[model samples]
Every structure is written in structure tokens, then in C-alpha cells.
Target: MSKTIRMLNKDDYPQYEAMETGIEFDYIAHIFDRLATGDNHLYGLFLDGRLVSVGGYSIYAGSYAMLGRLRSDLRFKGNGFSTEVVSYILNEVFKLNGIRWVGANTQEHNTSAQRVLEKVGLNPYITLHGALTKDTAALESGAEPWQPVTSLQRKKDWLNQAYIRTGDIFPYECYYPFPASAELFQDEAIKQWSFYENDDKTRFVITKYDQKKYHYLHAVYPWHDLTSQPGLWETIASDYRKLLQQTDDETYIWMDLTKEEAQTLPASHQFELPSPWILYGKEN
Candidate 1:
């Protein structure tokens, strides 16, 4: 008998939950449930009356929608189930015509999910800051405790190194949306960093963003500069200035500061919400 693809409605969630991991189940139940009853759409694949796969997204104020809670049962693996779900959502979302981008996030370890994303032709444009769970301070909204590290008093080198290996002292969601190899950051131009030594520990990490070339300026932690105590953040800034002086053109620089850092070295530069974001579509 052939497997049947079903238009999974909110009522079909229980069967869907059984086929997914706990996190996957809860995510679908909460997030997608809201979207389904509202303006969003949901779709699923059923084999022998069991829900094997599910996906969907919803649009908010923005022209595009976010793709989330996408999953298929492990037994259903290698069946192009994920590609099917993603394709279904894209087909629906693209029909609107004004949509620009579809955003989605998965754990760095979930290689399967990553392939599904690429197979569906969704571009990977973000290196989301990770969640700080261990050996770090919890961030209260509007609170930036990272000023000390940013200021670089004593342990700047050690912390910088840690950021590359473990992550920031704060925490971030690590990602490699494709099959990665022994060498990471193959395309990054700004691979090297040199640190500045100062008594104040008041330092700034000034990285230039090429609006023309939109890629992340990734930080390599354990800050392995050739010098035992080289100045990196400041050095990068100086280099950045040199490039600007040559080009005689200004570029955008986004600062991801801890609450303390923000309080201490808050940029005089004005900023606004980068962009309003949203998502929508049908899941296979």
C-alpha cells in the first residue's frame, strides 16, 4: 500500500507528537498550533495512519515568514520527508509573491535538519548568538553583564580563546547548517586578530560589515594570537580604520555587547531595530 499525505489540522497533533522527540512534539503543539488556528497553514504525511512528518510557518507584520517546528519520525528517515515538508511550505509561501526570506533555526548537531533546509533552497544568513547555560552569567533583558570581558581587564585573552572553543562567556547557539569539515570558516577574510594591552581594560571590538558582502565576522576563541598577550579587538579596529581610510567610505558595524559592556561603552552611534521579522506557509 502507498503512504498517504494528509492535510494535518490542529486536531491531528496527538498522532504527530508520538512520531517526534519531546522537544519537537511540544514545539509543534505550542507554536504551530497557534499558527494553524490563526492565519497559518499545516500539513503532514501519514503512513499506516501514523503521522510521520509535519511542517508549517506563519506571516506576521513582515513580508516573509519563519519556518519552525519541522520534523519527521526517525523511522521515516531517508524518505525525502523533510524535503517534501519544506517544499510544501515554500510553494505556499511563494504564492503570496511579496515574501522576501524564510527564516529557520535548528540545533548545531542536527545535521539532518540542516540538509532539509538547504534542500528546500532556504539560504543560511545568520550565525545566531548562543544560549549561555554553563560557566556564565544569565542575561536579564536590558542588562549587559559582559562589560568586564569587553573592557578586557585581566583575563581578556583567556576569555577570547574560550569564545572560539566553547563560545562567549555569555553563551551562543553554535551552527553549521551544512556538512562541515576539519577546517571551519573557510570563506572568512578577517581570520586573524590582535589584542591591545591597556590598564583600563576598556576595549572595543570594532568589526566592519561589508554591506555588499553579507557574511558573519566570526570570532575564533581562545583568541590564539601569535603573541602571548597581543591586542586583538583594538588591532582589528585599527585595521578597520585603515580600510575605511583607503576606501573613504563608511560601513555598518553591529556591536553585540553584554549589559555591563553596554552600560560602560555604549556607542554614541544611533541604532534602530535592524528589521521587523515574520514567517508563513504549509508543511508537507
Candidate 2:
């Protein structure tokens, strides 16, 4: 049997939604919304007249387009379908005049997905720590919770502290280099919180919640600031527990930390080992 690749439409959503993938439905919806608004281009692969896989790319600043939401049905496993779909997308990306580079990121534990990416010529480049707080005991420890940093001055102070302590070498935001401007503090997507010591902003944490599947806290910079501070992680853990308690849904909280930062987390906190999420890219 042969496979056919074509642009995906709203009609294909139900079929793609029914298929198993690491991407959550909310994100899937976000992708379709972008597609509808001309913010992204999505493509689907059909086998025997059924949509078995879907993928897409979105143009970003600096002549870059990110490949996202590449997923396939479980029944199609071992057929090299994923690699075929990715290769097709990469070819399409290169055809665009303004796109200079194409890239994607995958969890380190997802070896199967990584294999597909590798087969399509994307390689791993960096490791990021993903930590979760779910253990009942850890959450119930009664430590102090982080308060939201509402004032711009306080937010600026926290960022300045991070910059000074870390020397601005690490990527503060996912794969993109940390912004040199203070405007990062104003992003609506992220909410900033802090654990202060004696009215001084000793520690800070930034997080984004979808109010659905999960809440992701950005990777903390100068993690040593928090780890070295006595009982700070516990305080953060307590706050996390309180957040979980208030939510009736099963939304999980994830914190991205460096390998060293992850290791410093209290053993009571349940989390995955620090692993590298490779950013694979190709120049056009």
C-alpha cells in the first residue's frame, strides 16, 4: 500500500485527535487554531484513506521555523511512517524562501520518537531537567508557599539577581537564548513567584499553566541560590501542593531544572531523572 501526504484541515482534527500521541489535545487545538489563523501550516499523512500521522511547522523570528506536534497512531508503529512524515515536512520547509533553519525538540526518554527524528537527520544538542511534584508526603510538608511577584520592580530585581549570579550563560527560555532586555518579565504566558528570605528576594520561580493537563515552571537560573538557601525547595514544594489541592482536575506541575538543580531537589519530591532534549536543526 502507498501513503499520501497532504495539507491538514479542520475535517482531519477528529481523526488526528483519536490517534495516540505525546501532544495533549489542548496543544493540538492550539495548533489547529494557528492553522486557521494562518499562523502555522499543518500536514497529514494518510494510509489507506485514513489519517495515521500529522505534523506542522511555524515560522518564528530570525528566519527559523519550528517543527511541532509530529505524532502517529500506535498501530502504525515500526513502519517508518514518522520518519517519512518528518522528511516530507523538512523538504517543504526548505522550499520556503525565508526559512533559514528548521528545528524540533523531543523528550530524552522517548527513544522511539528520537529514533524517528534521527532517521530524519535531526540530532540532540542539549539536556533539560523536567521535575514533577506529586508525592503526597512531599506536598503536605507544610513549608512556605511562594507568593506572586506582582510589582515590576520586584520582577526586575529577581531577573537582575539571576543575571548577576549565572553570568547569563544558560538559555533562560527553552532553546532560545535568554533575552538581554527586562521585557521577559512582562510575558503574559509566564507567572513569576518568589521565596524571599528576610524581605529580600532570595529565590524566584516562573511558571506557565494551561489550566488543563499540566503547569510548567521554567528552569530556574543560578539554582544554587535556591538550593543553598535553607528550606527554600520545601517552601516551594508546599506552595505546589497547595496549588494541586485547589485544582479539582488532574493537572500536573512540572519544573524544568538543570541536572545539578534536579539532583539538589529533595528526595521526597517525585521527579524524572534529568535528561537531554536534543534540538535538531538543519540549515537551508
Regions of model 2 farther than 4 Å from truth: 1-4, 13-41, 47-52, 57-66, 73-80, 91-102, 119-121, 134-203, 212-226, 234-246, 270-284
Error of 2 at 244 (Å): 4.8
Query: Cα deviation in Å at residue 154, candidate 1?
Result: 39
lDDT of 2 by residue, 1-284 (tens): 76799888777778777777655544676557557346588888898888888778876543667786777887877788778888898899889887666777677778777787778887655456555555535433345544556766666676667763443423444443332334334444233444233235556655433332444433344555444554455545555566767677664555555566666666765666556565666656
Best by TM-score: 2
Q: Residues 1-284, candidate 1, lDDT per residue (tens digit)?
A: 45666556767867865774546226456655665666576777677787788887665333446676576788778889778877777777777755654556665456677778778876554343221111111111222212223323233444344343542222111221211111222223223322333344543332333332223332222222212223444343344455545554443333333223333322332332222111121222
- Compared with the true structure, model 1 gives a TM-score of 0.45
Q: For model 2, what is the C-alpha lDDT against the true structure?
A: 0.61
Report the number of the highest-lDDT candidate. Answer: 2
What C-alpha lDDT does candidate 1 achieve relative to the native structure?
A: 0.46
